[model samples]
Target: MEHRIRLAGPAEAAPELACLRVIARLPSHWSVEILECGTGYAILGLRTRVPAEEAVARIDEAIAVLPLLGWRRD
Candidate 1:
């Protein structure tokens, strides 16, 4: 098997950038927890020979931040 790597700037990452925005205007007193929010990035820094447990933990953490997982717009 083989793989390829690609790089992109914020503009290329978001075509019609303004249209794809998801705003989470949380209240002042409540907690502000969101995954795809500003400057709150999740880096799954997995090396070539890392342990499964470590990778799983990192992935879980990233998944936990996603607010749309249990949400529906229908």
Candidate 2:
């Protein structure tokens, strides 16, 4: 299955850089990639074999720390 997280409003960095930073903080076991990026938002694609609900929960938990980095879900 594939899940997506949209990160927006990167404070001092380009969208790609901000996404990279977020990816770096996520668990290495996760299969994550940058799907799309623009001036203020980046879309991260996560590919996993887990169930849908669990995948959502995992992604949510992973992104919980994004607010501290000046990014918010869009």
What's the number of clashes in each of the models?
A: 0, 0
Write down the TM-score of every candidate: 0.27, 0.69
Off by over 4 Å in 2: 10-12, 50-68
Best by TM-score: 2
Q: Top model by lDDT, which number?
A: 2
**Candidate 2 Cα RMSD (Å):** 2.7
lDDT of each candidate versus the true structure: 0.27, 0.73
Q: On a 0 to 100 scale, what is the lDDT of residue 52 in model 2?
A: 65
Error of 1 at 20 (Å): 14
